[model samples]
Target: MSTIYKSEAGGREIQRLYREALDTWPVPAEHLRLPTREGETFVVASGPRNAPPVLLLHGSGANTTMWRDDIPSWSRKFRTYAVDLIGEPGLSAPSRPPLNSDALALWLDDVLDGLGITSAAIVATSLGGWVAVDYAVRRPERVTRLAVLCPGGLGRQTTGWIVKALLLRPFGRWGLRHSARAATGLESPESGPVLDSVVATFMHFNPRTERLPVFPDEALRGLTMPVLVIVGGRDAMFDSHETARRVRQCVPHATVNLLPEVGHAILGQTEPVAEFLRG
Candidate 1:
């Protein structure tokens, strides 16, 4: 889980590969720009039109480019579609998105209806994970499997000061849009084209921390997918161990993996995540 891509050149290589892969990502015949009740355009970008789909939801304040790290590996197994959550950021239109979980779920449903995706395996990170649980709790039939990475919305009350400071505070959002990229080992700014992509993620996807649902434990407890729960042993944003414990207790059937060394940064946890995707 803690493999290092040492040297600026090494990191740049990954970025180079990513840019090339995206250039030829093969957009579907007719991509849809679904209109959510909130009046936003949820952009859906995907692979081959007919393959069984996998939905990739990026973390809060980040765009689909964050998936630039995992897409090559993922798009191989499942026809993947990375969506820009309505109202949160990216190319999605409406400035104000729904802060409530129920409305968020409706937005997702609209996205699926517009895309013609009846069912899929969802892979979500942090805030994205929160929405996935909300959807599983509401419309389990639409999702066949779920994989969440160090998800959020467990209990904001139990959250550590670091995460609360970064995600909960406005400054935290700015730091990532301006800072945290390097802390996540995306140091090759010129190589990976980090500045532009990361800034776009911040501008378009960053959520207003005050807007999303709070303390989402009840909805998670009601989820019914073949859930694969993952957490970094060193995660400081949310309690990784507590998250694993509570999720196991809530779902009973969920598979949990407590990875060593890695923290809230999922981009660097590529190998283990690659295997997790395969699993």
Candidate 2:
């Protein structure tokens, strides 16, 4: 359900699922609680009380609401679910450190089952994309379609800066404070609350790279769902060409596109993001 934060009168923002997703500049939808197998409920969102099901995941340091600017319109055509990753922040319950990849994916699977969603089109970016990839490999039956945006763990090239920041956690927050310009592809205070949440998630719920094993190339090759890989052309973290190559090599059936202008986050506004979701 769309939680109404605050907005000026005559705002262009549309009422979608959560106030953050749309009114916030990306997309907005309502919030819902889905229980994990452990009986802990994870905070997630779905479109208008009734739209085609689609699960949306946030990038690193970000929570489910980060999709605010891009998801409301899509909600008209599909039920968009933005997940607050357990251990990250927001509505999901946290697990103490040392969580494994299989546990994470299985808990996500349980969340979907708790939501009563049999299958969903998954749209994910950054760290969330890594989770999506792992889930697809572990449980293909639950995913109907997958769109990975600048996904990590592609087994091509890993940026030392990213690995350091994600692993250290504290340095990541310091970097966010000073590097707001480089933090996200889209620039707008419309994204402030979400960004703050991201910073918090980074500081507290950050994952230790060494803790959860990174996904191998074999895992990418195993996904049977139709996969769409989108990497920003300007993303310095991972070479777009390398990303495309690795994606093609990993998922033989993947449809790949490299966007020269988009950054690692790669989502904003409606049309471009919606195009991928529609596909």
Candidate 3:
């Protein structure tokens, strides 16, 4: 079995489910695999051929499936590329390079180049948010606009949930389900399928444990493009308040929204994010 999964059978099961999800993608999409320095990257491209490009990046432990709910609306207005981040639980390669190095940005450069895109608007969440910000900082001229959801780097990473999850692990499936809900903040009945997917993925997927390297204020200050940040007040993974504050303090012109009732997983903002990307 690959080190990224618990066992060979578990990995195969997860891949089977991912394939099923891709087959039912909400819109017509072209599944493209690009050769990058990191490895082969998988992307789901949709919408008009002539529309402006909008890149979508999902958080860690996730793939393009996370964008299914938002794709229909956004794709109508723009050519959208939902990229499966390298090393995550997706069809992409399992090469996880050091986050602190310039490798990720360079890898993104290759992705954009391979797609024939010079610049594009980016909407990213969680770990993907960190990546978007990092790329924007390193290649500000290439990012027309940026919107991040519960992104890391700016906030203080929280670990209380880790202890809670570990304590509940002894309870088995019940514990795992509860842990998924707590971590994702998806407790509504409508989110049952998503929660179930999360549980199934975590059963085999090994998530990254290293803390994200924080972007210095000097780096953030260089983002001249329009920026939007949305974080949940009750986020279990990072301090949302600090993230909001840092965005305001460092990128003074950027928009910041902190939803009091949400958690690490911020959903149902397809319109808001699409509007921002449109502008």
Candidate 4:
């Protein structure tokens, strides 16, 4: 199968950085490679053996390390599995599946089954949020509770954001950094290191081009688990207010929080998420 990375050398560099990032986990983690229909899936497991399971799915172009700051707190309360979604820039298989189909849901099922988890709470961000919602709608019995941060599929993606992103692509690292800050709503200086990492990945990896498929109202309404939705009022990728409104309209009992000061990148939300999971 063809690799998703730009080249073998670039792939190796990303892998090396990924390993280095893994070492920075706030808590000791067990790295496991589980066989799935897609291929081998990589997982970083932490927390107590007897605790309830919680799955952490990251955004596009990110791996399990996206939760480096959030994992320590989550792992303390529940057995946490930070999964590298297949076909992303992680150690997982590079098989790109159709986003509009049930492929992601099936892949998630394989991962959970391999981990011996029959049911788990899901905390997902951005693109990962779409995957979590998809799985929940398709296999509601397997999802205990769902929490999403600035997730897609709830509202229409902004064309302006796409145009701006495309325009910035040719300007090299500087332009990419600007695009990252704009997309994330993070200040460049304070977000420099992380943005640099993001740029590095973007340069070396082949990102998914397909836009996220919008989840239908019926699917949104089908989620039987307790749901928590958080969005940045200033998010550039999608209409955060609209997304929150849709969730509230579809799932009346769902908890929705709109942080006006925040943007597409949801950092420092681990506390509230942990509380929701514990509840």
**Candidate number achieving the greatest TM-score relative to the actual structure:** 3
Best to worst by lDDT, what's the order? Answer: 3, 4, 2, 1
Which candidate ranks first by lDDT, i.e. highest?
3
Off by over 4 Å in 2: 1-29, 48-50, 96-100, 156-176, 180-214
Residue 267 CA error for candidate 1 (Å)?
A: 2.2
Query: Candidate 3, residues 76-158: lDDT per residue as tens digits?
Result: 98999999998889998888889999999999999999999999999999999999999999999999999999999999999
Instruction: Please count the clashing residue pairs in each candidate, in the order shown.
Output: 5, 28, 0, 0
Cα error of candidate 1 at position 233, Å: 2.7
Indicate the residue-level lDDT of 95 in model 1: 49
Q: List the residue pairs that clash in candidate 4.
A: none
Clashing pairs in 1: 61-206, 89-204, 89-205, 90-204, 175-179
What lDDT tens digits, residue by residue, belong to model 4 across residues 118-212? 99999999999999999999999999999999999998887676678789998988888788778778774676777777888978888787889
Our model 2 lands, by Cα RMSD against the true structure, at 7.5
lDDT of each: 0.63, 0.63, 0.94, 0.90
Off by over 4 Å in 3: none
Candidate 2 lDDT over 1-279, as tens digits, reads 111112322112222233444345444444567667544654546466566788887765456666665665777788777786654444455453243537777788788887787878888887778788888888898888898888766634445445544455455566654343354444566756645654444333334344224566777778888888888876745566777887888788888988877766565535755776676
Q: Score candidate 3 by TM-score against the native.
A: 0.98
lDDT of 1 by residue, 17-83 (tens): 4445446554432334676665655444555556668887876655566676666666665677787
Ranking by TM-score: 3, 4, 2, 1
TM-score (C-alpha, index-matched) for candidate 2: 0.73
